[model samples]
Target chain A: MAKSRVLVVGTGGIGTMAAYALEKGGLAEATAVMRSNYDAAIKNGIDIDSVQWGQVKAWRPTAITKNVPDVSKGDVAPFDYILVTTKNIPDVPPTVADIISPAVTPGKTAIVLSQNGINIEKPLIARFPTTPVISSVAYTGATETAHAKIYNDDPDCQKIGAFTSPQVPAATAAEAAKRYVNIYNPTGTLDVLYDADVAKVRWRKIAYNGSMNPIASILRMDTPRMRMSRHIIDDLIIPIILEVRAIAEASGVTLQSDLVDVVIHQDPSDTGFKPSMCQDLEKGNLMEIENLVGEPVREAERLGVPAPTLKIVYGILKGLQLRVKEEKGLWEAKFQSGNSYE
Target chain B: MAKSRVLVVGTGGIGTMAAYALEKGGLAEATAVMRSNYDAAIKNGIDIDSVQWGQVKAWRPTAITKNVPDVSKGDVAPFDYILVTTKNIPDVPPTVADIISPAVTPGKTAIVLSQNGINIEKPLIARFPTTPVISSVAYTGATETAHAKIYNDDPDCQKIGAFTSPQVPAATAAEAAKRYVNIYNPTGTLDVLYDADVAKVRWRKIAYNGSMNPIASILRMDTPRMRMSRHIIDDLIIPIILEVRAIAEASGVTLQSDLVDVVIHQDPSDTGFKPSMCQDLEKGNLMEIENLVGEPVREAERLGVPAPTLKIVYGILKGLQLRVKEEKGLWEAKFQSGNSYE
Candidate 1:
């Protein structure tokens, strides 16, 4: 049988690592879609210095395409799976779903979403009604230190499950998810586990992300400083955890009772790690606010759950996101001169 | 009759203006205590470029003292009133009350608090239990552009009231408050009015300060930008206003009904004004967290009022305050290296 073909849409830290893992497994042919880094990657390939896999010099995937649509032209075989590992910023236009839609062969391709935040599969599910959606939660301290140079400190572990739709039967979706995991984890080096309910896993993950990410960004503190502040842990972090739990419960996902304790102490006090959201703000990049905090707050409101903590957190992140957008020239602020109070 | 001698403690923008006003009134002998700005203020005086009171070069008070203690060294009459116009950052050590305590004559001199926040007088009342505590809310757009070069855009107006205590009769406290206003507004050039309930007035002011000041600082937005963000107004600002109202009500002060709308539209869209707290953050100065947001939240908790929004806001601001303190070497953070979760 021909090798299973995979198209990775985003070649950021997570995408590059996932593609590298799939190719290293020697079960599937992986093609990376590099936009700006295409020339560098095509010429030099990717230099990955990872703790889990050691140093791999100038490693290239089976093929490299500048654009997604370019890979589909001229009698090419259809891709079995298209994995998206971009930042889940739904607030920005030309979302990941739209960007990867050109190459998707509707029902033939399984769309795998490996990113942060809860409800990230909604857009992909909306765009591809009949296609199987693989919901994935990727955990790896991977980052691109320089152009075409990746640095990963943590092991690549992914919790994989299928987003069951009425169009795709549970058995079919699960089979698709299992197949993708099998191709990526053939060597069993990467700890990729199949989860029966990825949505519950996402809720658990967001309990940490929804609390720590935005708060760390807003406070301008790293993990160590945040954990050190007693008020932050008790007053802010715990409340947000409780709020997330309420939101999850309202959405029919009952989080663990010890979830607050789990989240408060998730990072070691000396870790001093800055969350991705915090790094985004520091670099003036658009944050993953909409999916991480905004949607959850809106869902809470829709479900009649009192998510005051989340609402305030979302409000603050939204304002900060606007400032970032305005600074980056992605959005403009409109104001008129008049009296403040009448 | 001898002129009423008044010593102004904090000579920041507001303190400088108050001293200028009291000296300009010609009914009181105003003495300004300049700590860091003493040399420049004594050498150049305060060059006033006022919108209300036109340009006055080298405007000196009745006296200029380097330290509050020095003002009482020689054969000098006691100060009838000590007006404090510094930032209400009670979190920092050597509070304004403590700094001005050396020159205070407990029973003879009435301590006037012309600063921000609700329970600011608590410290003063605690320090000088027998002394009458006069609470005043000052509104002015004033800044020191250069060394001792003062700029006043908005007119100086103050709502004066007395903090009635069992130690001091309401009539005596009210009489002291009225007397200070009379001295400060003898010529009526300054719009100083007497308020029967300054606590209520402080609550109303905090509806703006508590919502706008911290949010602007956190978002790095000016007033105009804040008002233009509809979600910020509806979700963050209004909810904070409601929380402040709940806190105020639980503390025995009922806020107005249209407070949310009032706070929402308080600043004109084109004002582009950065509240004092925002400016403090920009300049890396300590914020007035204790009195402005901290006290209210604590009061709410004590009174069993659920101030979720305020608590979250306070939590965020507290963390940021830690950052500022760390930057300024006012505090040190301690962290330990261990497993985050067991």
Candidate 2:
């Protein structure tokens, strides 16, 4: 059988890592789709660097920008799977929907979402009902540094499964998992868990993200220091976790562990680890505050669960966002004035 | 009549300002008492440069540090008023109490607190019951730049009043107010209000301080940007103000207006103000968070008024404090390591 063609969307840390892993696993011939043409070229070059295998040379994948020609017109072949690893910002989902609609052949293609947070899966499924959409939880940490180089903090581990009504066939899902495991499991690197309780997994991830990310971001502290500080655990993290858990329970998702336990038990010596939310905050990028903290707090209010802690933190984070916006405005004004003087 | 001798204790911004105003208004011969010998000498030199008339100006009053000789001998008279302007940290009240105890004389002397916050009046009054303790609110701004120069942001105004219990006999309080108004009203700079609603005034000031200061500290943003940012107002300031109001209401003090209007509607263009809290945060000095937000929120909670917003911002601020502590520890460890190497 001909090798299945795969299109990995987004050339960020996660997207680049996924493409690299897929090509190394030999499951499919992958092409990374980046938003910028410059980024696409850079990402393709990095894929080429990852091609050198153990004591032998290996394969390289193609890179395509968002402006890639139609697959039906023979410009590029149809992809068997479209993996999206972009941040679920306001424009991302719709952008993905528009780009992937023409490339998707229902029943023949699968689109996997490996982004953060919950509630995204349902919306995408609603948008493309016929297309097989797989919800994925990535445990690995992939960091993108300056000059667009991708480094995998966690070498290999991913949890992928189907999350839908009239769920995809178990046999087919298992086969897909096996294929992924085999491809990425060089030197036994990837662990594939076929979780029927994917919602639980998603909520568990959300709990961790919700607790650590915002606290780290707002405080501008790394995860280890945040974990080590009892003040942070008692004051910010624990209350937020309890509130998030309440929201999860109300939404029918059972998170596996309590947030405080996870934070306290997590090693403080892992000083190199920064929550992704902190990375976004440092970059002055738009945060997932609404989805991470706001949505759960809003839900808790609807459920009549008193989430005072979450409400306050959400307000603070929102306040910081506004302050940053105002500063940017002032900076822009000054910059324009300077330009006029020049 | 000879000018009543006055000693300005805790010669920081407020203390120095009071001294300058008092001398300029020709109501008192003003002496400054500072914690350090350097500060006393510096402040004395500053007063010499800035004094308006050469009559009281030649009376360089006294500039004495704690270790200075006991100048108040048998024939030498004690100061009529001791104006205390110490910082509102945990160490402040005890330190100030110890320093000014010797200066307190039952009928002849009174202590005026020209500092920020609400709780200091009760403690000082309790400590020195026989001596009059007047709580005064300063509305103007001052910054100390040099040993011989002090800059006033709003030199045209200062407010002084008797805000204490077992009410300093109305006649005595009014006379004291008039005396203070005369002395600190250089070119009529002071505004003295002698209403029974002093608690309300203090609470209103507390509301403004609690709302603007801590958030400014946390975000490291200046007043104009913070006030202009709707996010900060909605997320941080308003909630904090609400918390303050709730606490004030619980304490039976009627606040003048909703704090939100004060923060949101306050003209940012006029003041060129940056909150003292931000200055403390930038300097990594101990913040007045406990007194400003924590104490009020705790009071509100004790009163069964939900201060969710205040609690969260307080938590985050506390968290930031802890993070700073950890960083300090790390820096100390690194320094110790370097010392060992040396």
Candidate 3:
């Protein structure tokens, strides 16, 4: 059997980690594709620190920058599996589609989405009707320090499976899963569950993120504080979780347990974690507001369910996002005015 | 006519400023009441900075602590006007009622509430149905420094009126207002509007405070930055103002202009303009949540109006309140635990 050639899109913290893991597993020849020329340069020269498997020996995989690799140059092969690990922002889906669409030949290509949240899968399917796109739920606490370091606090396994229609061969999906398991084997923590009902897992994770991330971010306080404070748990967090659960149920996703219990009660002191939402705010990056909280909230409204608590949290987070944009604009204006004065 | 003897409760910033103003204008003979027993000691050796009127000549009012001036003192005359400028918390009403209720004679005694928020009036009326209670709005900003210094910024005028039902005698209310104007002949400006629709004015101030204070407090950002930044204004501030207006309209309190205009478009360079709500948060004082936003929102609900914006702002503020409490508890716990360990 020929070794599967895997193309990992996005070379951020998660993308780099996944690529490194795949290379280490020896199941496939992995190529890391980044969006920027600077990113490509950094990947080639910079050493990526791995929290799970010590640094990957300064290993440099075949790196590409542009979305459509030059097929005439005969430098790239069609990918057996394309793992998309981009952040769920507006430009991500289109960018992924542009980059991976050419390489996704029918029956041979399996596109796995390892980002947080749902709804992105349908769009990918719409863009590439024949490509087998597997929607995976990734639960890990990881942060990239500089270009080189990826720190994973949770080290919990990643779960991958087909979440939508366009039935790909079960063998192909299994091969992709096997490749992931082998790559993540050294960490010995990758438990990739292939469920026909991937929506449940996605919804469950959404419930957790929806409840914990926004509340933690808006409060500008820690998770332990929220968990210990019954006031927050009862008044704000629980109600938000319930709201998310309602939306999930309406969308045919059954949540098993309360998200508040899972997130808040977990010993947050061990992680000293700030949610990605907070990171986005601090970095002045556009938050995953629409996909995570806003979309579900809209869905809840459409389904005639009152998501009062979720709406409040979403409003606050959205407000924070706008504030960030305004501040950035002011900064840019000030910069321009100073330049003019100069 | 004999000069009206007034007991000015709460010798903090507002109380001292009002006393100084009253004394300067010859509105009434005023006595300053302090909750602490060191009143005379602090008074005997006066700190010029502590006086609200800055350096003053003569006309030092009598200073009595709670224990020494227990209402039953024989020489104490029935207070014609009791100006209560205490912090507006849950305990304020009952505390004032306990100390001043005995001296409040029907038709003669008038309690001028110089506190923030509109909720206190209802409780005061409920407690002492016969004693006349007038709601007065003060625009002059004052801060108490050291023992005797009270600094008044620019404005010298206070708006006084009979705002609620079972209306006090028009003549008595006018008499009280005249005395207040005379005593506090504030240098900058003075206006006494005797409209029965004073709730409109109260609501207007509430609208401004409700919009600016909590956000300023939570963000710990200056008013100028908040006002100038579109992100802050459009996202956090505008939504809050809109909510406040909705609640005010729903509660039948007509507002002047819109809150957004007053809060966001108001000039950034205004002086002595920290949100009083932010001041409360800094002091770890119980915020006037019930009166400023909560009560009005509850009223809106009662009136079958949905105040979605107000509901979210109120919830966020409540979360902050709870978080602050939890943080304090944690700090206290750690302190105690350290002491035990030592």
TM agreement with the true structure for every prediction:
0.96, 0.82, 0.74
Q: Second chain only: TM-score per model?
A: 0.95, 0.79, 0.81
Best by TM-score: 1
Q: lDDT by residue for model 3 over A1-342, one digit each (tens)?
A: 566677777766777667766666665677767555346345554355445666554456656444645444456667777888877765223555665666676656778888777676777777877676777677655566655455655554577667455555556555555555555454555554555567777777777678778877777765655554565677677777788788888887777764556655544443345678867877777677766887778788888989877876775665566556567662322221111111
RMSD of 1: 2.0
Residues A115-195 of candidate 2 have per-residue lDDT tens digits of 777666666677677666676788766665633455555544567767663456656655554454445454464564456
> Model 1 off-target regions past 4 Å?
A70-74, A340-342, B70-74, B250-257, B340-342
Residue pairs with backbone atoms closer than 3 Å in model 1 (clashes): A336-B270, A340-B266, A340-B267, A340-B268
Q: Write the per-residue lDDT of candidate 3 for residues B1-342, one digit (tens) a residue.
A: 566677788776677766665665554677777654245435463333422345653336654445324444556667777888876656224555665666566666778888767666887777777666777777666666555555555454467776453656556665666555555553534453344456777877776777677677666555665654565666567776776677667777666664567556453443334677777677775566767777767777787777666666676677677655555662321211111111
**lDDT, candidate 1, residue A282?**
95
The DockQ of each candidate is: 0.63, 0.29, 0.16
**CAPRI quality band, candidate 1:** medium
Q: Which model is ahead, 1 or 3, in terms of DockQ?
A: 1
The better candidate by TM-score, 1 or 3, is 1
Arranged by TM-score, best first: 1, 2, 3
DockQ-based class of model 3 = incorrect
Which candidate, 1 or 3, has the higher lDDT? 1
